[model samples]
Every structure is written in C-alpha cells, then in structure tokens.
Target: MIDDAIRVLAGDCTVIAEDADRSEYRGRVTTIVKPDNTVLVHDIDGYQPVAWLTRADSVSSDRTGDFTLVAKKDTQTLRIAAHDQDGFAHYPTSAAGTPVGDCPDCGGALVRSSGVTCVSCGDRYGVPADATIRDDQCDCDCGLPKMRVERGLAFNVCLDRACESLDAAVKQAFDREWGCPEPDCDGDLRILRRGGLIAGCEHYPDCEVGFAVPAGVVDGECACGLPTFETGSGIRCLDATCDRALEGALETEPTADD
Candidate 1:
C-alpha cells in the first residue's frame, strides 16, 4: 500500500535545492509530495520539475505560518518556503489501467496495474504474470475479482493471493504427480515456492533436480519424464531449456503421409 499524494497548489514559494551543487528560485509554483516521499516543485518552467528530491529519507513540513517543506536524502536536500499559500490538500492516486472491480475494504475502484490495485485505498493484489483477470468476482468474503491462472490446469482463483492462494491450488493439483527425471533417483517432483514457483525433487539436498513452473497449463507427460505444458508459443517441457524433450515431442508428431 502507498500513502496519498500531498499537494500545495497555486502558491508563491521559494525553492532551494542542494546536492553536489546549489540552486534557488522564487515564483508562483505547485509542490507535490508523492506517495514515495519524493517532493516535486513545479513552476512555469517546461516538463521537468523546477526542484525535486527523489525518494527522500526524511520529509518535514510546517504549514503553521508559511508553508515550509524540507526533504532530504543522503547528500541531497530540497527546501520550499511559501510566502502566499492558496490550498494544501491530500489526493488519492493509483496506477492507470483497465478497471477490475471494487475494493471490499474501502469500496474504491480496483484497476489492473502491474497487479490489481485500488485507486483510492492503495490496496494491491499480486497476480500471476500469465493469469488472465476475469470479469467475474470471487465467491469469498474478500469480494475481490477472479483470475484464470494456469499451472497444471486453468484454475479460477481470487485476485487476492492470501484469500485463495495460486500456489496452494497448483500444489493441490500437481504436487507429487510427476516423477523426478534424474537417473537412479526414486524421488517424486513436488510443487514448491523456492524464491519462485517450481517443481523440485522430494529429496532436496541429495537430488538437486528442479524445474521452474512454465507459464501454461499441463498438456501431457514429456519423454524426459517431466510434464509438458501447452504454452502460448507451443507445447514445452517443464524445463524450458530441455531440447531433447522438444525434439522427442516433434519427432512423435504424425505427418500428412501417416
């Protein structure tokens, strides 16, 4: 979640910025304090900000008499002192994208950015990269949108991963379903979250065989003993780099003469 944007609008402010160098200006400007604590002072000047402090370590403001804002990073500092203030307020903002649904917590409009995010409340739900967000809503109390995520199969999961975890669904569907491809290894492949989603060997320390879950639904078993996935490109083995499996799959395909 992110904090709301704070703005000082239509004000005669003096800006002093210092890092490796020092610069100062005094004019009617607008100051924007972004959610990430980055301060931007805008004047009649072109596209770029007149003075800015990017993701400052500390940001302090005093609107008692004159609206004074000071933001500092490691070695950089940006200061703004307003002589005549017009308005100061906080506004909610979110990344722009296609609308998904409403936030159950704040009743804000949820849109798909990198993930599903509420514009007003700043609530975020992480989704799988290959998952397709559906128009239908979830059946859970969270009231979040649903997504079609493909592991071994396409599953309709809640937008909020915590409410209905994609990993749990995948694990339930495919865990221990495939045998380890390693020779002389009687271990089964277990679906796990080792940094990322992967089908790893049961005997981990002894047998280091593991493959990243492909961004597709399982089609069939591969000649390499791994599962073949029907990806966007084509059918591919769980181990994407396995040329032998791909070659075997191609070789088994029936020709026009057959």
Candidate 2:
C-alpha cells in the first residue's frame, strides 16, 4: 500500500501558483499535501481549490517558523507560505468505502480501499480479487473481518493471513487431490500461491504444469480427469482449454455483452 498520511497546514497563507501564467492567492486558506505529493490550496470562497498542483515529482517543506510547502511537477509549481500558522498536522487517511469492521491492532475503522485497510493505523490486509468482505466478523481473537472466497467451495475465512490463512485452508482441503493432466507425468496437482492462487504440479520446475484457480466453485469432474468449475462464464475445466470437457459437457451460449 502507498503512504496513507496527508499533511495539512491551515492559516493565513500566501499561495503562489506558476503554470502557463503566474498567479498569487492570499487568504485564510487550507493547504493540503496529499500522500502522493499533490498540493491543494483551498480558500473560504468556493468548493473548488484556489490553487493546486497535481501529483508532483518533487515536494519540499520547511516548518522552521512559518510553514512553507512547495510542490513541483513538470513545469508547474504550487508554493504556500503560511505567515500565521493556525494548525499543522499529518492525518492518516484512506479512501471512503464500505466499512468492513474495526481494526484489532488499533481501534480504527477498517474499510475496503484497494484492500482491507485501517483508516487510522494504516494496517492493510490483502484480499482475494474475487472475494467479498463479509459483515460477519471472525470468531478468532484477531477480531478481523471474514471474507467470502470461492476457490472450490465458498469459504468464509478471516482476512488476516496469520490468524486464518486462505492458502492453508485451500491447501488442506485440496492439496494433492488432483492428478496432473500432463502426459506421462506422475505428479499430483498441488495448491499454491504465486501472486494468485494456482494448482501447479508437485514436480514444479521439472513439469512446469500450472493452472490459475478460477473464481468459482468446483461443480463436477471433467472428462480430462480434472475438476470442472462452475464459474461466472458457465462450467469450465480446471485446464481452461481442455477439449475433453468441451466435448462431453453441456455447452452454454456465449453471454451477450450489454
């Protein structure tokens, strides 16, 4: 996750914005320095910012006495000098989204921003791309939110990997359960995570047989001796391109795009 802290300086500040033309703004304004170094100077006049610089390549601040913040991007620059600094602070922030639960480490609001994140403490939990954050909290001592993930079956597991690992659950349920579909390879399909969940050959480097676990539940066995997953697209073989499943299984009409 990127930095979730935002620097704020509010007071009677003189703002200088340089772009296609030079302009200066002076008032009791609020200067917001975003996590990505974007600077926004907002006055009491309107909802729109008086002056701003987009995500800058460089940002420098001097708070010796009167606070000074300068952000530069390409050829544009936004400078703020607070002559009478009223308040200056760095606040932990997160995107406003559906609240999952409260953070166990810090009593902060946990939200779905990129992943499950603590709005106050900045603690983050990686969730499966297809998983849904459930309202039902985990029973474990960690007190993290449970996520509904579908690998073979719908699994309700804790978001924190240390408390309840999704990989370990899947591995316990399905590891070495399938035989390798590769010709003459006496290897068992093993559950593993390499960026994403995958069922790879136990003989990894030698066999090089790996298939990404689709976001679906296992419905039946494929003619190719692999699992047939009931996915959003319909029924599909674990090996996406298995011709045997296509030949024997019921075919669904291609979904029309809206």
TM-score to true structure, per model = 0.83, 0.75
lDDT tens readout by residue for model 1, 1-258: 556665555599889999899999999999888778888888886989888888999999888987898999999999888899877888766788888788888888888878888888788888777878888888977778899987778899998788888899999999999898889899999999998899999999899999988888887667776878888998988987877756676468656995
Evaluate model 2: give its lDDT: 0.86
C-alpha lDDT of all candidate models, in order: 0.85, 0.86
* Candidate 2: pairs in clash: none
* RMSD of candidates 1 onward, in order: 3.7, 6.2
Off by over 4 Å in 2: 1-4, 11-29, 43-51, 64-66, 73-76, 81-87, 105-107, 222-225, 241-247, 251-258
Which is the leading candidate under lDDT?
2
Locate the minimum summed-lDDT window of 10 residues in model 2.
245-254
Worst 10 residues of 1 by lDDT: 1-10
As for candidate 1, its clashing pairs are none
